[model samples]
Target: MLKLLNQLLGLFCCFLMTACSSVPKLESNAIAPIVKLPNNHEELGVMSAYSDPWEGFNRRMYYFNAKADEYVILPVVAGYQKITPDVVERSVHNFFSNLDEISTFINSLLQLKLFVAGETLARFTLNSTLGLAGLFDVATQIGLAEQNEDFGQTLGYWGVDAGPYLVLPLLGPSSLRDATALAFDNLVFQQAINELGLDTDEELLISLIDGVDARASLPFRYYASGSAFEYEHLKLLYKKYREIQVAR
Candidate 1:
């Protein structure tokens, strides 16, 4: 059990070094196909109004995460993608995304987004039932678009300061609030699956599947950002993205 937990932790740290929030909000005027921290957000994401005091530590962790992704994480994801049929892959993606709405639903209420909480409930209901347990994304087709919410965003909504940038050992870039939120969310999530009848092993396996699916969906590659300044660029983008998420 300890070995499996360690392996899963390593996989998560390596595979997902990006995005506290889901992929950035879509924009009609956005130029980037991936839509992370839209260039237009010069007020914050272009550069930080605040400073990264721990940039030295962040840079080392960034390098470590990049190498891990290249050598361990991406290779595994590639193999999984190669073997899985596209339809099956899509189904796996949707199923996990649907399950994530449970967190979104709770976080929406925390953030006091009553309309969004309601929307999340409706989306979860429609997807789980009409969408075949979220394997088909029927909710999206019907217009109850999935909204990503998390405790980090909840704190932000409540006017909690981000309180300096910090990169977690396996979690990559995050503020103090987001990092703490991550830990709390994991605890809540574990209890949730426990109630749903997942044994520890089954829960770990499911988490693995979800992580892989999310990594597979991203358009970016580790250390392949095509610029020597990629790290700086990512910092700016992450800041901008999170700011938008908070203020939006």
Candidate 2:
């Protein structure tokens, strides 16, 4: 048991180092600050207006994530990209995306966005069957565009305040509301996997593949933003992005 626990910790630490939130009234000021760059672009007063109450812990986590990404996750991702054919990679992405539509559909319904829910349902149905288990995104070709909805957004839609900007280990940026939402989503996902009769080993394999695939798809690199205050900028971006998502 101890050996297994250590292995899991090591694996999570590897992920934590590789990458890199939120909220009150779901307001911008509560979670992040508006970053203003002067004409010379040399001065940034981001921290002065920033609302990262957990700045000490958050910055430490960010530093750890960046270093891990540089040494571990990025290399693994690069290797995966190198060995996998483009077409194959896209199919893997599509397959997972089709699975994600299930969560999105449910969240959309919870948020009372019936149209989006229906659309996601159609996308899932079409892609699962005609798209050959989502190896292809046939739904998008016909105008059933993919919609991004999650439990966090559902919470935001229901007026749950983002508790604070939180940097989650291994998972990266999130707010209190979003983090709770994430736990709920994970429970739902695990239940679905169980319903599908996936064994524990099979489930773990799929999760690793999903994580690798996700990392490959993301173009963002830690510390690559060329800013001394990358943490502040990332915080602001995440906050603003969630704001838009919740508003939508």
Model 1, 1-248: lDDT tens digits are 11112223433344345433323465888675664565546445434455789989998998887787788878889999999999999999888777778888899888889999999999989988888878889888878877877788899999998887876664566788887888767776676667669877988898888777777776456556445556665565566567787888
Clashing residue pairs in candidate 2 are: 17-65, 17-68, 17-69, 18-69, 21-165, 22-165, 23-162
Best by lDDT: 2
Per-model lDDT: 0.73, 0.75
Q: How close is candidate 2 to the true structure, as a TM-score?
A: 0.79
Candidate 1 residue spans exceeding 4 A from truth: 1-48
lDDT per residue as tens, model 2, 36-155: 435543233333444778889999998888788789888998999999999999999898888888888889999999999999999999999999988999999999999888898899
- Total clashes for model 1: 0
Q: How far off is residue 156 in model 2, in Å?
A: 0.9
* Over 4 Å off, model 2: 1-50
**What number of clashing residue pairs does each candidate have, in the order they appear?**
0, 7
